[model samples]
Target: MEISQYSAEQIATLQAKLEKKLGPEYISTRPGPGGGPKLTYAEGWKIINLANEVFGFNGWSSSITNLTIDFIDVHGENPPRYNVGVHCITRITLRDGAYHEDIGYGTAENVKQKAAAIDKCKKEAVTDALKRTLRSFGNLLGNCLYDKTYTEQVKNIKLPPVRSSTLLLDVL
Candidate 1:
């Protein structure tokens, strides 16, 4: 999506705020099945809260627009595995009444969890879709994680120790 000049400015401001609030520890790195490192969701509520603070309460929203499920036998097991995929749309309404909407897609396979395969797959797909949608917002919310080099670099960095006074519960 083409971001307007105003939106770009807002995003830059938000990026600064996010970097100050969240540290490298908030980014997760995992080895993909193919041996390449991948960035995974470590914490998502932080992004939601930051977005609310930047855009105002309820200024942003996301919804799942489509979902599909397929049963496949990866291991030739008796019980087929369910693979779920979802498409989601997220929108942010700017203060000036203009809006930006983005679409994200995600897929998840059966996790071997009990009888809750459907539920688990659905939840995983939704979370992945939301993460992708938020990443489309740019560098503010861990989009840099998409870069393998960046992910490798940050994987070893430690987050600063939290001071008692800076704790969210303490602030509350």
Candidate 2:
């Protein structure tokens, strides 16, 4: 992945805006191994929206550069399965003469029993690749979702104190 065109300050500003836009609703908890809490990620629509806000509508474009499928051995009593891998390249142009390109890879398995397995795998691969490519832009769009340790750290991070009266007034 290429380095981000945006500077640190610009990325920080974008991160703050994204945090405000995506509130607690974007975060979810799941059951991890040993009955521990696990962090779940929201969809990538927010990232796309933020990218559009930061850059113009045509600032970024993603397309599948390559795709391949490999057939695996069929197991007993199971349908034949194939592994599909997709390579996606995304280009983000913040402005004239300022741009970056990033490549992301995604793989998914599809079984013959499933109808439209190839299509489903392709969609999953595309989404995964997009998420990975977007995450290359640092934490602006909740990149912590890809990092377990960072997710835990974020959970422990303290929020600024809020005035109770201000909250009450807003509610009233």
Candidate 3:
């Protein structure tokens, strides 16, 4: 996927926002495991935590029980081709036993694709947990993202606390 060239103005805007939200510890484009420009996995998790808080992705017990990041060798050279980019594999398990293992890339296109799957997992976990946790025990199955049928059930939900997994499956 092609990285978009950011305008100077856009960079400035993003810088301002990052500075405000990230305080002094934020570092952009640090060296990743695959030698790409990105934060260390641990650092990236901190950013993820912040986003979850900001977006109120605060429901259900969801954890990345397993995560693996590696470089896919495209050519069979002696040392092998590496860092063409990285693959981030996440095995997410929800409290209600609804889970999925999703594959994503740091690239723009794949990131967008993975994000939708991630959001779906979030919605499924939350809705399922609510049913299990609530007194009335209602069915909340439907597509997320403004699907009208599940609106009432979703509206009555109170987002639960979030806990992240520490099971790192990093590979070289």
Candidate 4:
């Protein structure tokens, strides 16, 4: 459905839902290297699922607006390991044509093949950019995580559980 089909009430409802704080349960923490502050994040798959839940599959879309290999390094000649760095800018657009864009960087180190490193770097860059772009939509899409003052103690209203499709599950 187009943005025109979304009645004001529907738009208001979606806005309310998007404004809600993200649930703490959706976050995951990993210990940083060298005992630094733990790194916290919502996984890529979870981010995608949240987008589907809040926006309806047809309500929003994303595109990699720009992508390029920032650098590539190949180590020792025989069966060289390749290290590649990629950069991407992703744009997320609602059916209304409102959009947000964000940049992301991805690096692949110690990859056995040049092609493999390039592939991994590109995918990672796109996913990173997509996640960064989507965060602008609201906390449920993970904007809260970026806020230094955000507290996990604060609760988010419970949203009904959603059943994800088998295809999406398998593909992810």
**Quick one: best TM-score, which candidate?**
4
List model 3 lDDT by residue over 15-95, tens digit each: 344333232232223455678743311133444454344322542233433333333334445533332233343443333
Q: Which tens-of-lDDT digit does each residue in 40-158 have in candidate 2?
A: 66566866776676555776666555555433333335556654555555554454335445555555555564335556655665665676666555565556576676566556655
lDDT of 4: 0.84
Preferred candidate (TM-score higher): 1 or 4: 4
lDDT ranking of the models: 4, 1, 2, 3
Q: State, as a TM-score between 0 and 1, how close model 3 is to the true structure.
A: 0.22
Clashing pairs in 1: none
> Per-residue alpha-carbon lDDT of model 4 for 24-135, expressed as tens digits?
6677778877999777777888899999999888888998889999999989777888999999999998887889999988999988988989999999999989889998
lDDT at 15, model 2: 55
User: Which segments of model 2 are wrong by more than 4 Å?
Assistant: 1-23, 29-39, 72-115, 147-149, 153-172
TM-score of 2: 0.55
Q: Candidate 3, after superposition: displacement of residue 62 in Å? A: 12
Candidate 4 displacement at residue 3 in angstroms: 9.4
Supply candidate 2's per-residue lDDT for 157: 55
Q: What TM-score goes with each of the models? A: 0.62, 0.55, 0.22, 0.81
Please give the CA lDDT of all the candidate structures: 0.59, 0.57, 0.35, 0.84
Winner by lDDT between candidate 4 and candidate 1 = 4
Poorest stretch of ten by lDDT in candidate 3: 134-143
Better of 2 and 4 by TM-score: 4
List candidate 4 segments past 4 Å from native: 1-5, 151-172
How far residue 86's Cα lies from its native spot in candidate 3, in Å, is 7.4
Off by over 4 Å in 3: 1-20, 28-42, 57-172
**Candidates ranked by TM-score:** 4, 1, 2, 3
